[model samples]
Target: MIPTPYPLEEALGIGWYITDTPGTGGVLRKSPEDFAVEEIPLQEPSGSGPYLICRLQKRNWEHQHAMKTIASALGISHRRIAWAGTKDKNAVTSQYISIYGVEEAAVEELRIKDIVVRPVGRNQHPLSLGLLEGNRFAITIRDCTAADTAATVAACTAAAAVGFPNYFGLQRFGVVRPVTHLVGRHILQGDYEAAVMTYVALACPDEDEEVRRIRTEYRETLDAKAAIAALPRHLGFERSLLSRLAEAPEDHAGALKNLPPKLLSMFVSAYQSWLFNRVLSMRLADGVGLDDPVSGDRLLFENGREDLVTETNRRLVSVHLSRGRCAIAVFIPGSEGARIEGKSDERMAMILEEDGITAEDFKRAADFVGLRYNGALRPIAVKSEIQSGVLETDVSLAFTLPPGHYATTVCREFMKADPRAMI
Candidate 1:
């Protein structure tokens, strides 16, 4: 296995590549047109219903920001708009969104630059997160340094067919600042002050110099009003937290609570994702094969059923695995009791213990944030049939991934470049 170049990737528990072949060494999303994503809807929109389902197409827009813009044009709260998954801000993406109590005429009349919302049909219920079948991606990797791009592409594609670590991509944590998990760790530890400060004041070199300067100043001074005045208007989330802090300097919990529940919930979820990645890497480091299950391994079926591999059922589990009936899965710890029977779960438990967190901490976070962290199973590895080609010095890849999987995870294997290049 080849190690990743970026320390951030290593810190995030994405330590090694499954294949040791020389990487294509390229950058992704050099332009908005370089990456394209389209959601595969799980259910088609019904002809008639209360919820207006629209196919939203946008270039270079953050998912939440685009939703809010659409809601503002429709004169409704942003919460009224719902989607299955969040798309990257720097890519050209098309996905389905459900708008509550909005008419087709209103949607048609709405116009936003670099955005298009066309009503597909209606649904009886609003779309919720993870409601999609999957997403199809067409990505181009530009300025590749590979001596034989085709050979590298073929080699990576072959390795991917076997399997690759299904680690959560860097984007799960903020690509620019990557502090969501840090804030989450603070939240789980019941340090609301640290959580708020991390979210508001953490600075990254990738950010604009002015933004980084203000964040650094805020971190040093802890002067909420001064920070708020210095922050640009586009940094509304930071300003909102600072606003709450300015009003009540001691109310860190209150300041955190001021954030939208979805965004707030993501912090904890990012922490869970980070834990999963760590455990998955640990399993690989322990010489465990992802394609096969051993005693104490958890088997996740395509039907969403889970079973444990044991001495008694190891052969049967292997048979099922060969038939593509199930895959080895690791549980992302949450408020709900996650059994610590398997090797991966044991690793997770040890990490949690080292972090000084427990089920009670998760429960408290859920209570404080009004979000449930019911743990879920994720596959330890993913396999996809990649379509690849070389265009001059560039390489293009097309593939589809199930909901909750990150394309960047797959891309990382092909281009072992800096994580920031893929951002």
Candidate 2:
């Protein structure tokens, strides 16, 4: 349950530090050449290890698509290939992919469309999620004037000194079609039929005209079989879900189960992300300091440690915050071991009360689709290392951010354009 039925648009419209900073209005990801990312490995790979880590550069490839391609070339199942993070489809990105029980020579020989693989080294363990320290981004903002570049540089410099708000970027929910949170809400409420319709029939304006028309037809006719036939082959998720519905219209949960478990879990995570964004917005609106700690706030340090804030410990926490070694943290609500309590607890409770839900509601979601709520603390603001230089008509900016932080969150402050359009 949420106070409001997952307001997708409002959740995305979070605040920024330099609200009036003139934007370097330009296009990002105009081509694969425009945006680039390099994954920063957690540590140097051991020369003698069980896993082969391949450094790959891919152009215009979705994360899962790239995995499947690599898996096919390596003669292994997709699950055998693991990555640190999922890169965007619209960018030219470089990252390390690990394959267990694969030879170094075979990995070096593997090639896939739009992917360049180099055998970097080997590691003793698979590159699990959040294994990377951060990502290095070299993004080009096209068609910008000197003034635009100056504004962007100033924002970046200021952010380097004073951390920026850590709102989850638009991509976390959805960029093209912002309905992941909506579908998640329906599923959490145990309305599987609503979830199916939200995933399959809700046409988004941001999508292409043909896509909108197809979704519109499906919503109007309630004909799953016809809709599945009309949808393009690339829309495999939609096709499979609709095909299930066609066979048994009442089997909503079964239809949803047709999607990959990881992808299905993303819907639940999207909803949690939306709630955090909403609460973050409220806190900003209330004039709370983005990086400053208050009594009852939870303070997290860089050494993977945290302390409860109180009058007795506020001074110690302030010292850490001043040194840029710690930050005030907030929680994404979950059951038992997941939920956090302190200053932010009141805010979380208020939101839960407004939504007519308790923390216990999240526990019930696990009963359907294994949507377990694994909660964690996230900083309200994060420090970034930014280096910007202008070249001809384009402004190139390079920066590194911690794992789980969104680079777009920092860029949006400078660009002030549609975050989705930029990516």
| Model 1 C-alpha lDDT per residue in residues 1-423, reported as the tens digit of each score | 766777889899998788888889989999988999999999998788889999999999977778878888889998788888999989999999999898999999988999999999998999988999999999999999988888889999988787889999998998888889999999999999999989988888899999999999999999999999999987878888899999999999999988777788889999999999898888777767777677888889999998899999988888888788899999888888787787788889999999999999999999988889888889988888899989888999999999999999999899989999998
TM-score per candidate, in order?
A: 0.97, 0.88
TM-score top scorer: 1
Q: Which stretches of candidate 1 lie over 4 Å from their true place?
A: none
In model 2, the runs with Cα more than 4 Å from the true position are 1-9, 44-52, 72-76, 100-110, 119-125, 145-148, 337-343, 367-372
Task: Tell me the number of clashing residue pairs for each predicted model.
Answer: 0, 0
Poorest 10 consecutive residues by lDDT, candidate 2: 1-10
List per-prediction Cα lDDT, in the order shown.
0.89, 0.76
